[model samples]
Structures are given as structure tokens and as C-alpha cells.
Target: MLLLASVMAHYTWLAIDNLDDVSLQIQAEQIAENLQLTDGAPTLRLPENLQRAYDQSSGSYLYALIDSKRNILIASEDKARDVFSALSAEQLQRPESYFRLINGDGSGAPYYVLQKTLVGRPDLHVVVAQGHLHSDVYIDTLLTEFASHIGWTLPIILIGTLLFSVWTIRTSLRPIKDLSDRARMIRPETRGLRLPTSEVSDEMLPLIQAINTALDRFEKGFEVQRRFTANAAHELRTPLALLTARLDQLEESATAQQLASDIERMSRLVAQLLLVSRLENTTPNLEPGVDLNVVGETVVALMAPLAIAQNKAIALRRASAPVTVLAMHHQLEDAVRNLIENAISHTPPGTEVDVWIGEDGSLAVRDHGPGVPADLRERIFERFWRGRERSGGAGLGLAIVAETMRAHGGRVSVEDAHDGGAVFTLHLQLDKSAL
Candidate 1:
């Protein structure tokens, strides 16, 4: 970075040098314009300031007039080969208009040579040479004094610029930094915690919103798990207690039959609640391309006995070809079984329950029972909203199915059966090529 600053300084110095040089050249041009070269008369009469300047200076000015043929018409010191005539003709008629003549006196001598027309002869030329050791000896002394001045000046300017740049960058990023700190301080225990939305940076606002959305989902999951766990423990406890009490009362030949049935029913309800909770928390990572046809076959085989106990017939209708989808095979099969069982439990004896697997990765279950009310259709998918008002099986069966479909980027809904029964539809995101 300092190197970059130096490059900038170099360009700045070039501009200063050019400006100063131009000013010096314009001053010399003005002096040349003012000098008059009259015929047979002296052209330049020195001004008061000029004469005073020459007197105080430790160096003298030498003037000479030379003709076109190289004959010297006039010389400043013609007395006896004075110090001014020391230069050869080649040196006098140099090619360049302005030249610095150095070491003409003794060691360290320097002079500035400017050519002008001689007085009294416009065709004749005169060369005026003046000593210049950096323009003035006194000026050279001031240059050293300014050395220490620049030594402090540049660093002070650099330090100030660096401080300002730091402040600017910090000010621009402060909002995001504060956001990061606040978010970091929050933990899982603080489920309702949120970032300060008002002080958010516009650039980071979308990211913050997305994080808050995720937090909302996490909080919802926490509440559901907490509720489901508490309710499941409470609902299962009484049946288990009854079964234990009934089993304990059974003497040598006494009936223990009711205890066995109660245990079985209680086990089923507990299993259903656990499955619902698992589905609700299922992440996309847990689901994959599982064959729906095979899953359906498995669930149907498992539930046929339960259907028979309810005096209902379980039917599976699927194409001969395989149907595949991205889904949790067991969870999806469990959901379908819940819907089928609920339908079978509600319908009269001998009524057929059909589970159809379509070629489009669609699963539909329909039962010949009184259909659900339109108003309660939405509530049917909600946990614990058993519309005993229609047909009820702990009311969590369809809710679990809906949650499973969501985890797999699929959907589940209830619609009117074409044959006048309640139909549950589960559509999964399937790779159509698998058909």
C-alpha cells in the first residue's frame, strides 16, 4: 500500500516539476521580449533592480556580440584575454538554444547562458552568461532547513489517511458485526430469541430473515415434540395400568383375555404416536428413492389381520410395473396403513378398503364410509384433531403422512373419491424415468 502511495507521489512530483519549469520559461521569454535591439545603439539599459542584483551577487555577467561570419564584434572583457573569452568557438555556437555552462571560473562554478540580439544591431547576436549555483547561494541554504520539515510532514499525512480509512471500513461493516455477535449469543434454550431487525444491514437483511425463518421452524418442532411426548406418556399410562391390574387379578383358571386385548390396543396407540413424532421431525436427509409398490405390499400384508378383525376386506390394486419415489419407505407405508385402518374401523362389516398405487408415483386409499365434512377436511391433517365428528383413529394418522410427504418434498391431501368414498392422496416427487 505504501508503494502505491509512492507511485501517486511520483506523478504528483511530475506535475509540480512541469508547472514550475513552465513558469521559469515564461519569465525568460518576457525578458527576451522586452529587450530592444536598435540600429547602431545599445539595446539593453539595465534596470535598477537588475543592477542591484548584479552588485550583491558573488558572480559577474559576461556579454558578447558575434557576427554571422564568426567574427567577434564586441566582448565584455576585451582588456587582455580576460576570464570571459576562455571558451572555444565550438562552445560559443552550441546547437541548443539554452545550455548550462559549468566550472568556467574555478571549482564548482556554474553559469546559465541565454542568447539575445545585441544593441544597435538587429542582425547581430549577443550571448549573456550569468553565474547560477542553484539560482542563489541563500536559496540553497533554505533547502536544507526544509529537509526536516518534510521528514515530519509526510508521515503525519500518511498516518492521518490510514486512520481515516480504518474508520470508514469499520463504520460500513459495524451493523453486520453487531448482528453476528447477537446471533452468536443465542442458544437452543432461547427458542424465542431474535436478532434486532431494525438495526440490520440491507445487504445482510435477507440472510437474517432466512435464519429467523429456520428458528421459527425449530421452535415449532420443539413445541410439538414436547407436547407429543407429554401426551403420549399420559395416554398410554392408563391402559398399561389397567392391563397390569387385570393380569394381576387373573387367578389359576380366571380369564386374562381382556388384559391381552387392552395391552394390544395400548401398544398400537403408543406406536402410532411415536411414528407421528418421528415423521414430524424427519429431515430430507432421512428420505430417499424407496419403491412405493414394495412398501405398499408390505404394509397391506401387515394390516390384513387387523382389517379381518374389524370384519373389513383390505385390497391392494397396483400396476404390474414398479412405482418408485423419494420417500421414507417405512414412514410412508405406516401413514398409508393408518388411513386404511381408520377407514376400516369406521366402515361396516364386509366393506372393501382399496389401496391403489398409480403409475405416477401416486398412492390413494379409499373406504366405503360416510365421507368427511368439508369444514373439518383441513383440521383432519392437524395433530390430535380427530374428527370423531366423522371417523377418528387418534386423529394423528393423516397428520403423520402429511409431515412425511413434506420431508420428502412431496404432498398429501384428502379429496372426494370418484366412487363416493373418502380418498386420501399421497403424491411423491418421483423420477418419471423410474416408471
Candidate 2:
């Protein structure tokens, strides 16, 4: 807009200047036409209107008649006479017709002067000059009005346009933002989750549909994997139970005891596989509040015999007050049981594994063995990711504990124990209703 205004002002100025020049040229030609050669001496004849217009003492218009010898024959005013007399010899010898802008009468006001020689009497020259103060004032007033109008309106127009553009962009992208939020809710346990297509624009629809299709394939593959794990564990349970019965009948030998231990580990692995399948296929109901102290005590009691057999001991340290948390009962108990079993297996023969329940709905299992390495702590809870010190059992125990905590919206972490061992902690959401 500013550029447009500048261009318009420039053209306006040029147009006004051209019009003034033309008017000056026509006036000079009229004065020249009135020049008559009477008795071989040129004389200017002017009409009444032209004579009256130039005769004013302070008029903006003036005219003069001069001869080829640079002598003024007649002038409308003394200022015009002075202007003609002061011209340089070279200026007086200009072409037959010419125009010039000059500061005449030494008054700092500009004049448009047109000089023309008579067609028949070349010896006589007619000069018309108009003062430019009034015209300049008019042009300046016009430009000032235009600039003032634009200055006030342009900023308002720009601010309104900017605000409108922001609103339009945000409104147009609202559906995509909603789609992003919905995509974040998708997980392996959350089946049939897809971005809704109803409000999405056509440009984004194809990408959203493609993502949903990929999720469909992934969910189907995950379902198949879950079914296979569940079925395989179910199929192994009966044979393992029958084999245990048969082995008990021919037991009481060194080789038989080692084989029994191996069978127990395999049974535990099968149970964990079944648990993993169950956890993947469905979300556990964690609305029920369970006492963390009770769960810890029960798991400690169940695993005490195994700890004693391994020449280690297991003990439960209950909280001063009941530490209740939101959880599924069986799932929480199984998670604590895995932690206890893990602690007993890892700790030294003479050391004791402690299951501590905190008043803040937290439970920790500490073992007096080489703590998990700092880099491997997070990976230790991944499915089948046994580190260099792989325990005899399949690496599903810690993974199950992690899955259980995730189902309950809880957290599990392993950190260095103060007494130089590993401490595995479960941080669960406290049940305010139970409190």
C-alpha cells in the first residue's frame, strides 16, 4: 500500500506539472499571435480578459514582450520587467520556443516561463511566466491528506488481517491435533483403537487411514502371538504335572533331584508365559484397593521355604500403618511374588532378602548380591532380556513384574542399595478412599 501510494503521488505530481507546462505554452503562443508588425516595428495587442488578468499588482500571472536585441518593449508588471532585464545574453538567445522554471524577482518563489518568437515577426519575442507558490501549496496539501489517511488505516488493516490468518490456520488444523491426541492413547493392550475420520480434512484422511491399517495388522499379529503363548502354556501344564508325578515315584537320587529342579524352573517359565498372555490380551481392573503390606507378607511367606532351601532367608518388613494402593488383587500378589523369588535367587547364601513396605504405597525387594549394572537396569525388565548374569530360569520374572505395574498404572525401578546390593522398588498410586 505504501508503495502504491508513492507511485500514485509521483504520477499525480508529473501530471500536474505537465498540465501547468501546457497552459504556460498556450499562454505564450496566444501572446505571440497578438504581436503585429506595424510600420516595421512589432506591437503586442492583448484582449481585455488577458490584459486584466496580468494587470494586477500582485497577480500570479505575468507577461513581457522583448526584441532580438534583449530590450523589453512592454511588460505587465515591474517584476516581469526586472526578470526580462536580468536574463543572460545566452538565455535571451534561446530557441524560438522554450520553457524554463526559474526563481524570478529574487523572491524565492518558482515560476514557469515560456518564451516564444512571433511567427511573422521573428524580431519580437513573447514570454509568459506564472508563479508556482499556489500550485505547490495545492500539491502539498493533496499529498499530505493522502499520507495521513493511509497512515491511520494501514496498521489497523494489517493487524486485523494477521489475527484473521491465525484464527483460520488454528481452526483448519484442529482435527489433526485431535487425531494426534487419539493416536497417543493406542497401546498393545488397547485393541480397536483408531483415529476418528469424521472430522478430518480430505488432505489428512489418507495418512490417518494408513496409520489405522498398520495398527490393524499389528493388533492381529499381536493377538495371534498372545493366543499361541496361552495355548502353549496350557498344553505344557498337563504333561508337566504328569511328569512330576512320575518323577516323584522314582525320586531320592542325585540326578533325580537336579532334574526335579530343572522341571520346577520350566513350570515357573510356563506360568509366566501364561501370565504375559493374559496381561497383553486384557486390562486388569485396578479399582479395588489392596494393602501393600499384606501382599508383601504373603509373598514373603510363600517364598520363605525356597529361600531356606537355597541357604538364604526371606523376611517382610511391614509398614507402621497399612499401605493400601489401587490394584487387582491376584495380579499385585503375583508381582510381589516374582520380586521375592528374584531376590532369594540373586542374594548370597548367608544373606537375607528383605521385602519392605512403605507407608507411601511403595514396596521394595533388596538382595545382598551384585547389583544390576547402571546401563542394564532398564533393559533387565524387558521380556527375555537376561543380562550376562542370566539366572537359571527363563528371564520372564522381572518382565512380569513390570507388566503388572504397568497394568496398575504404577512404576518399577532398580537402584543401587545403600548396603551394596540391588534394590527393586515398586511405586504404586495410593488409594485415597482406603486412606
Candidate 3:
């Protein structure tokens, strides 16, 4: 708006200035047209309207007729005579000039003067002058009126345009915002999730469709991978069971016992692989809450025999009040079981592995062995990532635990215990309603 106003003002000034010059030129031409030679003397016989426009009493418009000798032949007023006669020969030779008469009865006011040679009477010239004060008053009044009527509305118009632009942008991009919100909900567990294109604008439709197509390919590939894992695990279970049974028939020697342990670890690995595939393929139900104390008790009881055989005891410390969390029952139990098994495997023979269920929806398993190094804490939860000690079991237990907690919107972390060893803690979202 400011630029528009500036441009308009500049052009308007040029037009007004040109109009002034054109007006002076027209008056001079009119006087020349009225020039008549009477007995070899040039006389200006202006019409009544022209006579009134150049009225002597007005003192705003004046004209003079001069001979080649610089003698004034006729003038509208005595001031016109003084204004034109005082001009230098160089100025009179020019077509147009400005003059400010400072002599008697001239008022010392500035005037724009035009000198034109009389047609067919080259020896005679007509000089016309208009007061600069009059033109200045006219220009100022016109500009003032324009500012009063039009200029003040520019700000209002600019503000209204800005508001309208903001509203238009927000309305146009509303669908994109909705699409962004829905895109955030896509996760590995959420299969067949795609962004909708019904509400999107034409400009954004292609991009959204491309993203959906990419998601389709990714989901298909993920499904293939998950199916492969599940099928392989299922196929291995039967052979592994048959092998275990065959080994059990003659497993009374130390070598046979060691083979049985290997078989057992292989079976555990296959089961965990199946569990991981299931976790990826299915979304766990989190409607009702699960009690951490109950899960801890059940898993501890199930693993008690193994812990005793290893000469390491397992202890569960339940919270005073029930600590309920939003999780699937089987998945929550699996996560707790993995933590307990990891603690038992790492703990020293004579020391006990402590399992604590806190009131804050936390399950902590503390061992009595060397703690996990700070550098490897985060990597320990990755699939197939074993510690430097390289425990005999496959490195899928902690990875499965991490995946379970992630699916349930929970997190698992490992920290140093008070006395020694690493404390693996699961922090889940508490079920306030259940509490």
C-alpha cells in the first residue's frame, strides 16, 4: 500500500506540473492567435473570456505584447509590462522562463512566463505569465483533498488484506495439519496405516499419495520378514523337541548334560524368535490394567527351579499397595520374565537376584555381579547384542523385553545398583483408574 501510494503521488505530481506548463502554453498561444496588425502596429484583441481570465484586477494572470526593439506594445496590466520588460535578452529569446518582479506594484511574487513569436508577425512576441502562488495553492488544495478522502483509507485496506490472507492460508492448510497429526500415529505395529487423501488439496495430493505408496511397500516387506521369522521358528520347534527327546534317552554323562543345555538354549532362542514375530504382527490390548506384583510372583514361581539349580536364589519384593499399569497381561509377564532371567544369569552363585515391584508402576531386577558398562547399556537392548562376557543364552531376551515395553508404551532402563551389579528397571504408565 505504501508503495502504491508513493507511485500514485509521484505520477500525480508529474501530471499536475505538466498541466501547469500546458495551461501557460495554451494561454500564450491564445494571445498569439488574437494578435492583429493594425497599420503596422501589433495589437492583442483577446476574447471576453480570455480578457476576464487575464483580468488586471486579479493580479494572478498577466500578458504583454512586445516589439522587436523590446518595447512593450500592450499588456493586460502595468505589472505585466514590468515583468516582461525586465527580462534579459537571453531569457526573452527562450520560449519559457520564470520571473519575480520586485519593482513598483509588482508584489515581488514569482510567475511562470511563456514567450511566443506572433504568427506571421515575427517581429512581435506575446508574453503570458501566471503567479506561482496561485499554482502552489491549487496543488496544495488538491493534494490535501486527496489525502483526506483517499489516503487515510490505505491503512485500513492494508490491515483488512493482511487478515484475509492469514485466514485463507490457515483454511487452505487445515487438511495438511490433520494429515500431519494422523501421520504421527503410524508405527511398526500399526500395519496398513496410510494417510488419507480425501480432504487434501490438489497441490498436496500427489505427495500424500506417494507417501502412502511407500508405506504400502514398507508394510509388505515387513510382513514378509515377520512371516519368515514366524515360520522358521515354528519349523524349528518340532525338530528341536525331537532332538531333545533323543538326547534325553542317553543324557546321564557330563557331555550329554552339556548337549542338553545347548539344546535348551536353542529352544529358548526359537521361542523368543516366535515371540518377537508375534509382537511385530499383533498389537497388544491395553484396555484393562495388569498388576506388577501378580506378574512378578507368577514369573518368579515359574523360574524358581532354574534359579535354584544354578545355585542362585530369586527374591520378589512386592509393593505395599497394588501397582497396576496399562499393559497386556502375557506381554507384561514376558518382559518381567526376561529381566529376571537376565539378572539370575549374571548374578553370583551364592548371592540372590532381587526383584522389586514399586508402587510407581516400576519393576526392578537387581543382580549381585559386575554391573553393565555405561557405554553398552543402550546397546544391550538391541537384537543379537551380547555383552563382553558372552553368556551362553542367545542375546534376544533383552531385545524382546525392550520391544514388549515399547509396544505397551513403556520404557526399560539399566542403572548401577546400590551395592553392585546392574539394575534393570521397567517403567510403565500407571493405570490411574485401576489404582
What would the per-residue lDDT of candidate 1 be over residues 22-60, giving only the tens digit for each residue? 433443444444455567543454567854654455455
What TM-score would each prediction reach against the true structure? 0.47, 0.70, 0.70
- Lowest lDDT 10-residue stretch of candidate 1: 78-87
**lDDT digits (tens) for residues 206-320 of candidate 3:** 9999999999999999889889999999999999999998997894999998989888988999999998998887766785668889999999999889899999899999999
Candidate lDDT (C-alpha), each: 0.67, 0.81, 0.83
* Residue pairs in clash, model 1: 40-120, 41-120, 43-119
Where model 3 places Cα greater than 4 Å from the true spot, the runs are: 1-174, 287-289
**Superposition-based RMSD of candidate 3 using all C-alpha atoms, in angstroms:** 10.5
Among these predictions, the greatest lDDT belongs to 3
* Residue 105 of model 1, lDDT score: 47
**Whole-model alpha-carbon lDDT for candidate 3:** 0.83
lDDT of 1: 0.67
